[model samples]
Target: MDVTQVLRMKGGDGDYSYFNNSLLPRKVISMTKPIIEDALTNLYCDMNFPKTLIMADLGCSSGPNTLFVASELVKSIDKIRLELGNYDEPPEIQMYLNDLPNNDFNTIFHLVPNFQEKLKKQTTPNSSSPRCYISGVPGSFYSRLFLRKSIHFVYSSYSLMWLSQVPEMISTNKGNIYMSRTSPPSVIKAYQEQFQRDFTTFLKCRADEIVRGGRMVLTILGRQSDDPCSKECCYVWDLLATSLNDMVVEGLIEEEKVDSFNIPQYTPSPKEVSTEVEKEGSFMIDCVEVSKVNWDASTDHNVILFEEEVQGYNMGKCMRAVAEPLVLSHFGESVIEEVFERYTNNIKISMSKEKTELVNVTVSMTRNR
Candidate 1:
């Protein structure tokens, strides 16, 4: 799949919209608040407390959570400025909310006014009111999106896991959309090579944009174990492949079609990420942490339970929100609902045996001169 064109979270405010079903990313944002605040403080000190701060949130999708990191960064920077007696002449925060070209930029543009107003009210009147200029940048993060030595602090959550494109010449991983336990060593190597090339380019692009000593905080789905095919990273795709195979048996979709459909995504281990950072020679890894988030991480207790169908349904929504667009483009949208319905049932059966979750690897880094 061409990720730049097809990979986008479910858009708009509909029932299956990403805005409605993105509690997982929201929880991730909340959990990483302290990291963001700390990074902002250090970035301020690194920049020598400049009068203007340039920040960007890469892969920022449309939703309440889109501006979440930017909002927190604003508060943290403003607080620091106030404590340092610079409130009366606080820095201007130029925040760029970036996502794919097909993303719902209008939703974010419409919300900019409200976000600016909210930030204004959070600070005192005489405190120079840290001016926030929020704009939507539509492009792929794998390439250069900003000028050299431009941005100071970069934050991205649940985004870097998406590969720029699927690896070439992988004819062995039939009937599977992603890396699975049964995938051959060649398939695993293809994914690893793709991630390395893409991530290296990612670091190079950011290195040119960020100033020396600039900091970056990224959170993406990954595996704790060194094995790339571990269940924590690939089981969901395994179950998804199972559902699609069932459809093939029932003549809903052709077998060859399933064989050719591979998702352009990968979850790198901490070692993989650190190795890339070290090899890229532009950034130093500050911290790499792994956290488990249940499939249904929403606040509603009913949504987290697997005994009933509610949990499965919620989980289905979560997956559909991110996968529907790509699946629809390939499957013609006819079997979309049915595929998810079956996928949900599979999840219910699996979760009953054990608490299944995805591992999020959060890595904090700083640009090195």
Candidate 2:
């Protein structure tokens, strides 16, 4: 599916009522705070030199969560300022909030004014007005976006797996993954290729965009290990497929429509990601860890907690948040509600706080000077 169609299909006014707003930037920021903070601290000597450094949050979703990263960033930089007693030369940060063009900029941009207000109350001793500038840039992260050697700290959460285009192999007869029970070797290869392509370019672009000592902290869905062929591969792809399958069998959707669709493989093993980074040869990996994301607090009594937890964002984000339009293309709006119900039930059955976890990994690396 193209970007515009995707935005509309997954639009708040559209048929995707189950996408769940939880996937918005707010959750991501909450989810990724610790990692981002640690990286910023390490990069800027605990953010002491914020005015001199450049920090950018790329592919940031639209919502309050988007502010989470910037807030952590400014605070970290401020902490650094206090320690150095150079409160006068506070950090100058350029915050870039990115997303698909259809992402609600009104909501994302609103974060800036809120941030300015928050900073006003907590101004440091040496602080003059912070050189903190936030601008909304809409585009695919896979292509060129940043200035060469300009970024000091680059952070992205749950956003790198998308490629500029769908894998070509999926559209061909040789495509084994879309037709097979599990991800076929060909499909896996195709996705692996796409990831490598996207990742290498990402590193290269960052290498160009970041200064010599610049660092980046990126967290993306990753496999528990390097094995990509496993059935319990990636939650986004496999579970989403399973969800769609339920809809197909129930006659709510067409089988042919799904036969060719492919989920951009979001889950990669640490080794797989490292291999790609190594290919770029510009960044040195500092950390790669897979941790559980506690997104679902729902137990038997989901009553208010589930709704409260979900109410912050649109429900359309729940069922098809990651790939709503693609799934919709196969199932259509007629089966929207049922798809989300099945999607939720299947997840409840398959996932739990104790056993199954939202598998993701964080990679922190500094650019080669």
Candidate 3:
């Protein structure tokens, strides 16, 4: 399947919806809150505050965290306004919640009234709060989504690791859905080149949308090691490929199908990200951090009792939420349960040995004036 057709979180508020199972991403959002706050505060101090503070959360899938971010940002801006005492009145806020066109926006919109009400209650009885307007901008973030020089701050969490589309014109790496150690040098190069192109495009587009001195805080799944084939970065896909190969051996799925399926994802190193930003020439990197999160951090169940089952089940569900749609799009939906069952077993065994983790890279950039 092509990148556009395959890339989306499992939709709806159902069992597999990102809303129901995106705990990892939700946690990442919380972890990055301090950075977001600091970036906003810095933006205000660096320039004359505007009447309407334009901001956007790119790749904001449908979930509670969507409105929660909006609420927190509005509050932070208000606090900064009061502390700085630069404006006569609190600035109004225009927040754009962005995501793919296929995202379940209804699920998010249903909660908007409550979000607005909460914001309203936070203000004093007589005093007015800053007017907050929330809207969804449905599209890919790799391209332009706003007017030139419009947005002041942009934030994306647990996104940007997703390539706009899978790399084109080569498929030597067989039986793997992503870049793996077994993948040839050509395949690795292809993936890296695609990332460079997509990320450069992303920075260029955001540069146009953001006003001079605007700031963006982005948190993405990344790799600490320079090699893309490192265990922390590519082991998940390796396990997935192993499961698919098992299916191939059992005649449940065709080997050719497995060979052709390439996941449109990339976990970049810190250097890779910084290089793109510098090459794009639109933004200067304010800060870049690479942190690690344990693979089982989101698993709250009793691991001692149902160690394998709990770990495997939780891991499967988490991955399914993010990749089920793509898997369904590529292979029929019928194979999803069986494939994940095998994947669960593999993860259960893998987790028993060494603790796996994900490296999260958060980059804060300011638009060059």
Candidate 4:
């Protein structure tokens, strides 16, 4: 499948839209705020606080999370200026929101006016907020999206795990949609090699665009273990594969279709990420952190439910918002609701036995001269 043509979150603010179901990503943004602030502060100081700042938020899906980074950066810079006694001369910002061509850019554009007004309200009477110029750039981040040496900083969250395309030789990865304990050795090797190639290309492209000493911060779903079949990385897909297999048995879908489909995502280990960065040789890794978030993280943690049904339903909706387009394109609209319904039941049963969590990795880097 041509992933660029199909990979996108469910659009709009409807019941199943990404905008309503993106609490997990929003939580991630909050969790990494310190790292993002540090990177921006260092970039601003190192660049001597340029009068104009240019930056991009890669894979900025249509949601409030799209502008969360921009807001944070502005607040950080404003605080820095206040401390340095330069609040009177606020910098101008050129912000780019980037994603695949199919993303819901209209929803994001509609929010811009309110975003600007919020910024205005935050400024003190004695000082003015920076004038932020926001524009949408539709494309894949695996390729160049900015002029050479033009960007001052870059940020992406929960995006890089998606390979540009599925591995060419994974046809033998039957019965599974991602790396699994039952998958053949060749399937695992194909995935690892694919990630190395795509990640290297990503660094090379960004190196050409970001100026020397520019900062970049990325967060992705990742595994702590070097083993590709580790539960942290592959278990969720396993559950999804199980859901499809159940449908196949009930004659709801063809086994052949299930055998041919594979998700175009890979959760690399921290070591894997460092290896690619070092091998690519364009950026230096400044910080790497690994954290665990419950699959039902968006729900209130203080409320302990005796029943797992609510948690399962929450997770099911979240995954559907992100994966529905891909599934819909492959299996047709008929199977979308049934497949997710089965997936939710599977999650409920599994959680009844034991809770599951996702492993997230955050990396901070700087463009080298």
Candidates, ranked, TM-score: 4, 1, 3, 2
Better of 1 and 2 by lDDT: 1
Q: Which portions of model 1 miss their true places by more than 4 Å?
A: 83-86, 124-128, 299-308
Pitting candidate 2 against candidate 4, the one with the higher TM-score is 4
Candidate 1's clash total is 0
On residues 226-328, what C-alpha lDDT tens digit does candidate 2 reach at each position?
A: 5665544554345556777666678766777666666544467788888888888999887877766444422213344554324322332453554556656
- Report the lDDT of model 4 for residue 179: 84
* Local lDDT at 95 for model 2: 82
TM-score of each: 0.95, 0.82, 0.94, 0.96
lDDT of model 4, residue 217: 96
For candidate 3, lDDT tens digit of each residue in 269-305? 9999999999889998989988887767557554335
Clashes of each: 0, 21, 0, 0
Model 2 whole-model lDDT (C-alpha atoms) = 0.63
- Kindly report which residue stretches of model 4 are placed more than 4 angstroms away from their true locations once superposed: 300-307
Residue 42, candidate 3: how far off, in angstroms? Answer: 1.0
Candidate number of the best lDDT: 4
Model 3: which ten-residue window has the lowest total lDDT? 300-309
Candidate 1, run of 10 with poorest lDDT? 299-308
Model 4 agreement with the true structure over 1-369: per-residue lDDT tens digits: 899999999999987888878877888888888998888888888988789999899999998888777788788878876776765589999999999999999999999999999999999679998889999999999999999999989999999999999887735788888888988898888888999999999999999999999999999999999888999888888989999998999999999998888899999989989989999999999999998888777554465473477777777788889889999999999899899998878877777788698898999999997
